[model samples]
Target: MPELTMVQAVNHALRDEMRADDEVVVLGEDVGLNGGVFRCTADLFEEFGEDRVIDTPLSESGIIGAAIGMAMYGLRPVPEIQFSDFIWPAFDQITSELAKMRYRSAGQFTCPLVIRTPYGGGIRGGHYHSQSPEAYFTHTPGLVVVVPSDPYDAKGLLRSAIQSEDPVLFLEPKRIYRSPKMEVPDDDYTVEIGKAAVRREGTDFTITCYGAMVPVALEACKKAAEKGWEGEVLDLRTLLPLDTDALIDSVTKTGRMLVLQEAPKFCGYGSELCAIVAEKAIDVLEAPIKRVAGFDVPFPYTLEHVYMPHADRVLRGIEEMMDY
Candidate 1:
């Protein structure tokens, strides 16, 4: 095993997948020649050639539409939407067509594709590049939303997503893309989707989060520990088809819950998580569930730190839950 950054792990996964399956093709703006905006697909153009590693026009809808067509024709297409904020142009293709192909065709057709996009605040990408839009896709009926926190899971989950016989929305947090290297296996492996990983074990309370917010939640737990409260940290790597069983188990033991997210609070993913706990495991909770999330307003340029949920906000939410 070797330590690799999230971006490096992503590149490794693409290379490995391309080698293993001829059906796997990479397509998106600057993904081929330019190696993607973040270099997640670097050197792939030379290795796989122009036919396999395609560089598409500057149309998000066209990119997704072409990918959907390719998938229908039995090719595994991994299309990268340069930024999650710019993905709206292809929303109809994703929600209406890509997500509904299997159900609409009564299992006669399946969209074996992955839409990779950089998401979340931090790194000062402002509103145009840093929006967290996983909730919208997660609400769709047939889509699988996955957000990996570290490099290890980033590679494994991506491999799993590409291999699955369904459309997967793979949201990569741009904040820590090049930071925090983690040991990842060089062999073939896949992280099971729809499973929540308990990063840290504790009994005082449980902090559930995913993507960039996972690190913030862990930091909040560390802060809590310093104040004599050991908070368990649960990373919902797979957002849609959430691992509620894992969530309930941890909340049941901790008797308190704090859900965190970089997305806005109103009708956000954290609210859905909190609602699930309130419905299924409310009896086991010692206090009301708390949710720490970005404000409802649009992501601001100058107030990046204020807009995104941080360790201090999560710690405050945890303390509020405990005191309640």
Candidate 2:
């Protein structure tokens, strides 16, 4: 095992997978010669050559449309959308065609496609580049939504996504791409999709979060620990087929819940988690479920800190829930 950043871990996964399987091809704008805007695909072009590591046009729709065609024919295509904000142009192709391919064909075909894109705020990208539109795709039935919080999960979950038969939207949090280095195995491994990880265990309350917010939640839990309050932090790695059992168990044990996310509060992914607890574990709740999230406004370039939730904001929510 060797220490690697999230970006390096993702690159290693891509390189390893492409070596292990010839059908695994990477296609996206600047992914080849540029090694991707974030350099997640660094050196892949030189190692695998043009056919495997392809540099695509600027059109997001074309990138995904071509990948879907490749998937239909038996090649596992991993298309990279430079940013999640730019993915809307390919939304129709993903939701209508990529997602429904298997069901529509009555099992005749499957889209083993992984659409990887950098998402969320932390780098001060304005409205055009920092949006978190995961809620839109999570609502779709056929797609799998995955967000990795650290380098370890980044590599493992990506391997699993590439191997999955269903179309996967692998959202990488750009904020912690280079930080939080961790020891990751050189050999292949897969983190099962649809499962959440309990990052911290505590008895007082449960804090549910994922992606960029995972670090915030962990930091908040640390602050609470110093105040003689224990907080359990649950990282919801896979969003679509949520780990409902783990969520309910944590809430049931702690008797209080606070959902954290970088997205807006209204109809955000946190709302779904809150609703799930309210529906299934209402009897175990000692206090009403609360959420600390981004403001219901466009992601601002200057006011990025004010718009997104921080450890203090999360700690305040925890205190309120504890006092209630």
Candidate 3:
């Protein structure tokens, strides 16, 4: 076992997959020589050389279009989109072409590809750079959307994504890229997609979240413990194909639920979680499902602290749910 950050774990997964399978290729801007903008692909170019690691022009649509072609031809391509905020430029290619490959072809063709992109706010990235557009893709059919909150899951989920036959959107939370180092196994392992992990267990309430908000929820649970409110933190690592069983179980046990996300609250991912609980576990609910999320506004550059959900804000939401 070795201690690694999320970024290092991502690089390790890419290296391991590329070594195990020659078909696994990495292509994106600065991913070859520059080691990627976040260094997630550091040193891969020197080892694999040009054919396996390619640097492309600054075009999201072109990058994705080429990767789709490679995938359809039997090569497992992992294309980097730099940031989730820039993914819209290639939305048509992803949602229309990439997503519809298997269905449109009636099982005759499948696109085995992973689109890697850093997402969410926490590094002062303004409106252009800091946006959580996960809801858009999660709503789409035939695509797997994954978000890892720690290095351990980051390595495993990425490996699983590369091995998946279906196209995957791997969203890496840029905030915890380097922090929260953990001991990750050097051997091959994988965290199954579409499963949620219970980061903390409690009996009073459940705090459901994913990606960067997982840590924030955990912190709020810690603070709530001091106030005699035992909180459970459920990390929904995979947004699409959500682990509905785990979600319903947690809410049923605690009898209260709080959904959190860095995205805007208006029609955000949290809304779906709330709806799921309301639809399936309404009878067991003791109180209204509370939500603490980013404001329904553009990601601000200056007031990020206020716009984004924090531990204090989450604690308040917990208190309200508990009191109700």
Which candidate ranks first by lDDT, i.e. highest? 3
Regions of model 1 farther than 4 Å from truth:
none
TM-score against truth, every candidate: 0.99, 0.99, 0.99
What does candidate 2 score in Cα RMSD to the true structure?
0.7
lDDT of all predictions: 0.93, 0.94, 0.95
Q: Cα deviation in Å at residue 51, candidate 1?
A: 0.6
Q: Which residue pairs collide, candidate 3? A: none
Q: Show the colliding residue pairs in model 2.
A: none
Clashes of each: 0, 0, 0
lDDT at 139, model 2: 88
lDDT of 1 by residue, 1-324 (tens): 799999999999999999999999999999998999999999999999999999999999999999999999999999999999999999999999999999999998889999999999998988799899998999999999999999999999999999999899999999989999999999999999999999999999998888888889888889999999999999999988889899999999999988888898899988888888889888998888888889999899998988889899888988898788
Full candidate order by lDDT, most accurate first: 3, 2, 1
- Can you write out model 2's per-residue Cα lDDT over 1-324, one digit (the tens) per residue? 799999999999999999999999999999998999999999999999999999987999999999999999999999999999999999999999988999999989889999999999989899978989999998888999999999999999999999999999999999999998999999888899999999999999999999989999999999999999999999999998899999999999999999999998899988999888888889999998888999999899999989989999999999999889
Regions more than 4 Å wrong, model 2? none
Error of 1 at 184 (Å): 1.4
Looking at candidate 2, what is the lDDT of residue 124? Answer: 85
CA shift at 3, candidate 3, in angstroms? Answer: 1.1
